[model samples]
Structure formats: structure tokens, C-alpha cells
Target: MASPTQDGVLEALRPIVDPDFGKSIVDLGFVKNLEIDGGRVRFDIELTTPACPVKEEFQRAARDRVSALPGVDEVQVTMTAQTRGRETPQGGEDLLPGVRNVIAVASGKGGVGKSTVAVNLALALRGTGATVGLMDADVYGPSLPLLTGVSGRPETRDKRILPHEGLGLKLMSMGFFLTDDSPVIWRGPMVHGLVRQFMSDVDWGELDYLIVDLPPGTGDAALTLTQQAPLSGAVIVTTANDLSLIDARKGLAMFEKVSVPVLGIVENMSYFVPPDLPDRKYYIFGQGGGARVAAEIGVDFLGEIPIDPRVVEGGDRGRPITLHAPDSPPAAALREIAGAVARKLVVLAERTPAIADANISWVTN
Candidate 1:
């Protein structure tokens, strides 16, 4: 009996079509690292986005197809996802070299837990086996160093800033450069320059997703990022309350004015669930305000994150709940929101024509 080969395996998988793009995984360049050891076979399927709805379906089909190949005794299939835009890069030293998708997590006002959402969301995406980076663009209030549980200034290597790594993520933040109590009071131009440097100077090699934590409000940071980064889309973070909702609308409008697609809205601190009463629910922030705002704005309502004390404790203690207490309510909620965000990326990538046109300006620079 003859053993199976890589070519034969590729041929078998060439027929598996991605539901979002209606193209075979092989033809779409999703298959990676095909290996054959006697009767055993293993390979990875890199989806266009981590939130692809047909992820499980694609995995099942690939395994079944490869297992049916000649002399195949065992088959293992791994799924990986990356965000892609329509614009193709020109040959040269690439800008943001190795970064596939950039997502800005923004808000219209402060104290809405935007940093917390950004940190947990990045961890959630990393859980899906895609390389992820969390860039803290909130110069005045960089919290990733504390949230990711890592503290120290980034190292310089060959003139490129090396991001601090911890909690299964690569992180860059102004927090790392300052003491916990120090303040960053810079002019508008300085702030813009720093944001630009973060994008062009950091050595984020080959990340599947770079989740940017933008400062609260539709101010200089948000405007600078919208005009500069090759963003796949923006995820607006809002709380369940009238004031927060009103500000969130401004954030949404800012993205719209800049032609940045609003992927969805995440309702952080949506409600409060007392630890003592597991079954009881409390309408602390006023119910359904986030969802209502999302509907009113005509963007996808990613999901709601109930207010939990652990979430606050985790952030203060430099331990994100998504990693420390994966089973907790807020942690689980973050994962769900992450999944929804991922799925929304797929929709944006497939359905939006602007992403393609926008890519041309950044990818070729």
C-alpha cells in the first residue's frame, strides 16, 4: 500500500468552499502547513476572519475529505483566522509589515470601560489561535500594561520598538513608558505624532489582528487613527445609560464622517449581577440602552457585558478576567462579544467595498 502525499491531500481539500466568499479554501489560499506522516495527516485552515460562521463546517469538511484519502489512518485539522482587505500590497518593505487587519476600539466618552473591552477582546481573538496585538493608543490613560498583567518599557531593537508580551498578547502602550502615577500632558500635534509612531515604528511581526485601544471620545486620537491606520473596521464601546449612549453616537458619526465602517457596538457594564445571588439580575445601568442605540444607529449589536466586580479587580491587578477567570460571567461575555466581533469582521470584509478602496492608500504606501 502506498502512503498519501501532500499534493493528494491538497487536491482533496481543493473542493471545500468558504461560505462567505463562495471559493474553495485552497483556491482562496487558506490551507497552510500540510504534513503527512505515514497514515497520519495534519494541516491548518486559515479563515479570512476569526468570526467566520462556517468555521466548524469548514473544519469538519476538511477533516472528512483528508481522512477519505488513500492510506489515511488519522486526520487532524486546525483552524486559524486572519482579517483581509480588498487592496493588494505592492512589492516593497511593507507598512505595518506582517499586520493583516487593524481594528480600532473607540468610544465617545470616558469611564465606559473601553480599555477593558479592548484588552479582553484581543485575548479572546488570540484564543482562536490567531496572532494578536493590543496597541494602547490612549496616551492620557494607557491601561494595557496593567490589564495585560505586564509592566515595563518596550525594548528597542534595530531602531524598532519591541512590544511587551504577556497574557498571550503583544502589547504597546504609553503606560509602559510612565510610572503608574505619572501623567501624559502633550499637545495635539505631539499626540498625533505619537499615534503615528506607534503605527509605523512598532515591530509587530505578522499579526493576524492589531486591536487598537483608542482614547475615549471623538477627539484627536480617534481622528488621527481614522485618517492614518489601515483599519478593517472600528468597534465602538458604550455603556448602558443615556449619557454614554449620546456620546457613543458621536463616536459612530465620527467614524462615518471619515468613511470608517462601524463593525458593531459593545455594551459594557450592561447590567449588574450580584455575586451572592447567581440567579438574580439587577438593572443597575438601565436596561437595553446599548442594544437600543445599536439598533437606532443601524450597526450590529455585538453583545452585552454585565457589570462584574472581578472585571474591575482584574484590570487593577494586571490580570484580565478573560485569562484569569475564563469561566466567570464577564469573561464568558467577553468571549461571546469577541466571537460576534470576529463574525462581524467577516461580514465587513465580504460585504464592504470601501475596505478594498481604502486599502489601496495604506497597503501601497
Candidate 2:
């Protein structure tokens, strides 16, 4: 085994790139120091700015990289703030109360299974032993109640909107407020205010994950989530259809402009299956459009879910596909997506979040 030296350590640090600057800390002057003594490694990680929330992350990455070197025995990492300017405004250190990791599931166009992904992802996250909440921010089309199978209006306690429940998930949706006969037709600010109230006035109660289902398009609703509060991240839903990918790009660009990280993209309806004949996938739309978009944007291609009638049937039945067919191909895809998202949140917590779990105060005892 080669001896642990500063040069070898520096070589190992080359790939740990900063998300804000897109450069290696070793080359970008963020790595403050490197000390190696008989396989014991101690390093100081200095961020480009003092407002860096990812300090812990850079430290962890450095430890992992250096610890993998030929003769490293123990690793000690320290983080110090040193920067050229303000850190990237990807949300901030202080997060919303009673909401730990808030992820918005969005799409460019409707009928692309955005809410389905939101419902199943939240459920799957719960499957990982994390308490989760689902909020339907789609005022024009609040389908969470339909998907999660919770109905009736949310009651109020001291003017706080009570959230509903769905198979190990706490939930809120516009459907719980308005009747099927009524319609919501306000502009951007109004839509934004309604969502803000959902965040502020609802009794979300201690959640490790709060999955928000937003209406399709890069419209007022999407703008509200990006502008009103700090979001953990966003997942863009797409399909193998080129048009959907194009729309997904618009939504992705919105997050980039707001400095929020794109967690990844989900390819829904990637294939098709029949009840009688199961071994065939009819590429009814196109092929690999979501994967291509993820590659182009340099983000993770979480995975794909086949277009099964069961998916829609499950929704109509108020049961997510993940709940019924826990091992089916589509459910497996959603679970993989939920897992990918769960891991990314851990990284995001190091970068911009200080609290491990938010929305604890609102949890029902």
C-alpha cells in the first residue's frame, strides 16, 4: 500500500466538486488544509463563502475520498467559513417549521402522472420508515384526496386547517376545501397565497418528508413554491414523450433560476402492459425521453414506471400503486425513485438545511 501523502490526498480530492461553483474544492481554493500523520487524516474545509450550508457535506466527502486512499487509518474533518462572496441562495439555513424536507412534484403538462408520483413517492418514503405528509397544491386539480383516497373537508382547530390521512401518510389537498362544483380561477399571487396558507395554517405534524403535488406547467403554482418558501428540492415528472420532456425542461429551468437544486426527474408512462398479456411493453408515446432529459441536465435519471391501467385504477380506488403492488414493476420504479430522493435529501441537509427533521411540532401525539 502506498503511504498517505498530501499529493495523494490532493489527487483524491479532485472529484469532490462544489455544487454552487461547479469546481473541485482542491482546485477552487475551498479546501483549507490537509494534514496526514501515519494514516490519520485531518482536514479543514473552507467554503467559498461563510453562508455555505454544505460545509458538513464537503467535509464528509473529503473524509470519504481521503479515507479511501492506500494507507489512511482514521479521518478527522473540520469545516471553516471562508468565501469570495455570498453563498448560493438555494433556499437558506433556516427552514420552515413542522416541515422537514418539502419536495414539490411538478410537470410541464397535465396527465403525465405527476400526482401519482407524488402520492406513491410519499408512501414509499414512509416505507423507508420516515413519516411523510402529502399536500396537494394543485388548486385547479387537487387529486391527492382522490389518489390517497381521503375525502371530506379538513376541519379546523383554533382556525388551523386539519390535515387528512392516507395509508401511513398525513395529507392535505384543495379537494378537502372546495366542492366538486366550484372552481378556482385566481391569478399568480392568489394561488401563491393559498399555498402559503396550506404551509402555515395546516396541522402538518412532525414529518420527515412532505411531498407537495403541484399542478402541471411552470405557472403561478410552481412560481409560488419556488418563491414563497424554502424547498428541499423538486422532482420533475416526465414521460417518453418529447413534448413532455420539453415542458419538464422549462420547470427545471425555473428551479435553477431560483437557486433550488433539481433533485432529479421521474419518467412516468415509460411503457405499457395489459391485464391478460403481461410480457409486452408498448412504447405508446416515445422511448427514453425522460432519461435523455436527465442526462442533458446532468441530473439523476431516477427510473421509469410502465403505463399500466392498474396505476390509474389504483388512483381511482384511492390506493397508490406502491401500496397494492409493492413488488410490481411500476411500484418498484416508484420505490427506487423514493429511495433516490431520500438519499438526496441527506446530501441537501448538509448543504442548505440545518435541521434533520422539520414539522415535528405539528405531529399528533
Candidate 3:
């Protein structure tokens, strides 16, 4: 029989819905087991994806929602991810084993500074004492070579591709294979295979974060990476420009189909202030576009980075802004955002208390 508080706990959660699935977790039978004593509540929750970020969120929400119950004291939610995947037609998660965390930086449209955001953010994460890797998934326009300043062909040993070191990062890109001035073209499946090979054949080593700078707009590369990598989360990069917002929406939807949690949204090139006039602000791409999209998607708006010319110079010279001018505005913003993102990833690995079931007691007095 259910106590008043136990029933009240369930009653409070009757309206919570999964952000991606749009179904109530309780109705989905994700609330596996429940027990109540005195005022504490303990339960096991299951998810359609073992690594779904919402697994923790649901628990936290449950805890908060149930704490309002008449006699509740504590809430314990043990979440387990179960593979309930239906075959995703194109961009569903087909994670390569052993990949720690893959974070893709994407944009809704070109010229919105998505690539710049990716490079700087990757550098910022490195600053936080984590081993990081950058995959130039934008094969046709591999900017990492230009940004990282590694031009020679990547050497191969043991038949596995060795990533080039740039701005203190391990890198793999098509630009390494092409001359600095060469133009290249690729077919669909061929390009897809290349993305796959980069992941399977490279020696990524023990990386804490793998920042993948995806091509502008949702396309083959975006879909391919989603299917090939065990991505922990993604960051949608966009400007405050209307066109960019449209593109950002497409990218967000692409990741959604594959069950990828959008860690947050990043507004890049958010503001441009002239050198002479520090106080005057220029809304070059319009204001609040990125924040608006973030709200619309129900994701955390990590932060906005001002357009810094130093960033372009750094990328052009094979030095990322975070490395060249760690004190610069954009670099500082990236560092903060990077650290926050890393913390968000770890939050998914919530620790379960090891208390023996028989050793617990509830006080009703």
C-alpha cells in the first residue's frame, strides 16, 4: 500500500515530460522501483538511452517535486540507461566504443563564426587541465589546419593515423592532406567514410574532451559524426543574425533525432565594438538572436562571446586565441564556457549511494 506522501510524490510528477521524447517518464514505465519509509523516498529510474543526460535531470526533478510532499524528507533516484533504440535512419547515435566525450560545435548558417567558436572553445577546455582533441569534420573546408597551423601530412604508425599537434591539441583533418591553397571536392559516401576512418583509425589516446567543429548547417558531416561517435553532448554556435538562427535550428534538430543532448547554445560574434570606441556597441548581426534560440530550444545559454579580431589573427597564425591571448575577452569567455560544459558532462555520471537496503531506517517522529 502507498502512503499519503508516496502517493503525493507520484502525483507531483504526473506532469513532467522528457524533453526529447515528449512523453512522461512515469507513463513510459521508467520509474522502475519505489520504496518509502518515514519521510525518505528511494526509486530506480530507467532510460531509453544509457547515457541520456536527462537521466540525472529526471532524478533531480523528481527529488525537487517530491520534496514538496506533506511528509517527505529525502529522495533517492538510481537511474539506469537501457538501450531502447529504434534504428535511426540517418543521424542516430552509433557511438564508437571508448570515446570519452565528443562535443560538436555547429551553426545554423555560414559566416556566423562557428569554426572560430569551436577552435577557441577547444583551447579553453585544454586550459582547464584536460586532454583535448579537435576533429575537423568540416572536410570540404577544413579550417583546423589553418587554425592549428599544422600543414604537413599526418604520419602513420602501426597503420593507425597519428593526430597532428596544434595549439596543444591532437588533430585530424583533410587540410593536412591538401596544400594550403588547394581546392578539394568529395562525394557523399566517400566523405562519410573519411569521417568514420578519422574516428576508428586515429590514436585519440586518453582525451577528456574531443571538440568536433562541424560544417555550417545540418548536412552529411553532422549526420555522419552523430552516427559514428559516442558524443556526450553538443554545442550549437550561432550569431545574433537571423539567418544563422535558422541554421542553428536545423543543427539542433539533427542532433535531436540521434538522441544527443545539446549541452548548450553559444552566441559567437555577438557584439563588435570598434577599437577607438570601447563604450559604443555595434549590433552587427542584430541582438539576442542566439539567446532567443536557446530559450526556444529549452537549453542552457552558456554565454555569448564578443567578436574579437585577435581571434582571427590567432587562427590565421596557427595559434588559437586561448593560447595566444588567454586574457582576451573571447578567450576568457571560452574558458568559462568550456569549464561549465565539462562540469555538465560529469554531472551525468551521478554517484549512487552504497547504503545497504537492510541498514536503513526511517524516523516517523
Candidate 4:
């Protein structure tokens, strides 16, 4: 028996609609490189985002559809994702030419461990064998220097700045430029310039994910990032407290106003466990507040991070908990949250192609 034609394979996959584009995969240009050799069939599905949510569903649908054809002995499916606008920033220049996805980690207020989550999330992504970068956009209170244990100013070659490297991830932050513990007294415009410079000036090479540590609140730096850079989406970090949730909603609303999708909410410092009495759980900050807020706002509850003293020590020592204590409960939780956030980003990336469309204007310079 002879194998089916490539056209027949595509015809079978016509019913599979890409969840993000609201059109058939065939129409969306997702189905590609269809090849059939005797009883073997193979093809690739090119997705809009690496964090695509319906990846599994699409694979199953495509495999089953192709295998159902006559004389089909085995069906092989491969998926590859890429972003269209990452090379172009708002200034009509290619900033991060090799980067694929940009994720902003923001919070409604400070003191909620936002930087900690960002640092560890970057490390976890690196653990998954993907190239990653961590940028501390918290100009006023840049703590990535402390969290990642990287100090000193970045070097420049040929006028392009190189990011400080640590924990197997490239990094850029205003923290490296400041001295002592003094505050940055810049005006709104200055802050905006710093954000733009961070995105444009840094030489962040091809990255699977660039996790941005945004300044807390829905204020200047946050506004600058959403407008100046090409972000895949934002992740809201909040504690398990009523007031935190109240402020988190504002942060979520800010992203919505700019048309940047909120990937999900992460409840930080959700609980604690006593080392001596290892069996007991302590609700230190409160409970269910983050999940409730996510439900109220119609977003995903990514997961929770427990209040662990070691998390603080790790930060102080310049090693993220995810890398310092990979076996601890908090480390396990952080890794899980990182994976969830990554997956959601892929899904949101496909759904919100307009975000890339809005800010991305390719310039042939």
C-alpha cells in the first residue's frame, strides 16, 4: 500500500483550530513541512509562542488525524515556537536580536518578595536547558544584584553593553551602577529612559526567556516597560493578604490597559513550615487571598510560594533558593511555579499576537 499525499495530511488537519488565532491551524500558517514516506508521516507545527498552553492538545489532534489516514503506519509530530517582534523595540531598532520571549514580573506593592520570585524563576528556566536573562527594571530598589549575588558594572564592547552573568543567566540592572544604599531620585522621564536603555542598550543574546524584575506598583517603570519593550506578558506577584490582593488588582488592571496580557497571579509567602516540627503548616501571611483574587479577575492561579527563612538567607548570600536548596520545599514550589508560568506564557503569546503587532515595527537599518 502507498502512503497518503501531503495534501491529504493537511486536509485532515484542517479541523484543528489554533486556540489563539481563532482560525484553523492551516489558515494560521501553523502547519508546516508535511512529509510522507511510504507508511511514515511527519510534520512540524510552528507556534507563535514557546509557552503555548494548548501544545499537547494540538499534538494529539494532529497525530490522531494523520494516523487515521489509510496506509499510515506511524505519525510523528514536532513543535517549534518563535516570536515575531522581539528583535524590534519601540525605538525602531533591534535591541534583543536573539531573544525569543520577554516576561515581566510585577507586583502591586513592594515587600512581597517580587524580586526573589523573578530571580528564582529565571534560574528555574535556565535549569530547563533554555538560555535565559534576568533584568532588574526596579530602578529605585534594584535587588537583583543582591538576589543573584552578582556585583560590579557591566562591560561595553563596540558601544554595546554586556550584561553581568550569574547563575547561568545573563543579567542587566541599575543596581550595578549605584553606590551604597541611596535611593535613585530621578524624575519620571529619567526613569523611562533607564527602562528604555535597559531594553535597548544591553547585549542580551538569543534567549529562550528574559525574565524582567519590574518595579513594584502600577507606576512609571511599569508603564515604561509595557510601552517601551516587547513583552510576552506580565505575572502578578502578591502575598496571601487582603490588602495585597487589593493592590494586585491595580497592577493587573495596568497591564490590561496597555493590552499586555496578565499570565497569572502567584501567591508569595503563602505559608511556612517549622523545621523542628516538620509536620505542621503555618499560615503566616493569611490564606486563599491570592487564589481568590485570581478567580475574581478571571486569570490563572499559577501557584504559591511558602514563607521560608532560607529564601531570605539565599537572597542575602546572592544565591536564589531554586539553585541554593533545590531539595527544599520552597525550592520545589518555586520550580513548579516557574514551569507553570512558562507554559502560560506560551499560551498567552499565541492568544495576544496583537501585542507584538502593536509595538513591533520592523526597521531595515
- TM-score (all chains, Cα) for each model: 0.81, 0.69, 0.68, 0.77
**Model 4, CA-based lDDT:** 0.80
In model 1, where do residues sit more than 4 Å from their true spots?
1-46, 50-94, 242-245, 352-356, 359-365
Which is better, 3 or 4, measured by TM-score? 4
Clashing pairs in 2: 48-83, 54-351, 98-359, 99-359, 100-358, 205-362, 205-363, 206-359, 206-360, 206-363
The C-alpha stretches of model 2 lying farther than 4 A from their native spots are: 1-95, 242-245, 274-280, 351-365
Worst 10 residues of 1 by lDDT: 86-95
Residue range 143-239, candidate 2, lDDT tens digits: 8777877889888999988788769988888888776667778687788678778888888877777888887888777776666555678898887
Error of 4 at 231 (Å): 3.2
Which of 2 and 3 is the better model by TM-score?
2
lDDT of 4 by residue, 87-151 (tens): 33444555556777788999888888899999998988787666899999987789988888888
Backbone clashes in model 1: 0
Q: Best TM-score goes to which candidate?
A: 1
Regions of model 4 farther than 4 Å from truth: 1-32, 39-80, 83-99, 179-183, 273-282, 360-365
Q: What C-alpha lDDT, on a 0 to 100 scale, does residue 275 get in candidate 1?
A: 82
Number of the predicted model whose lDDT against the real structure is largest = 1
Global lDDT scores for all candidate models? 0.81, 0.75, 0.71, 0.80
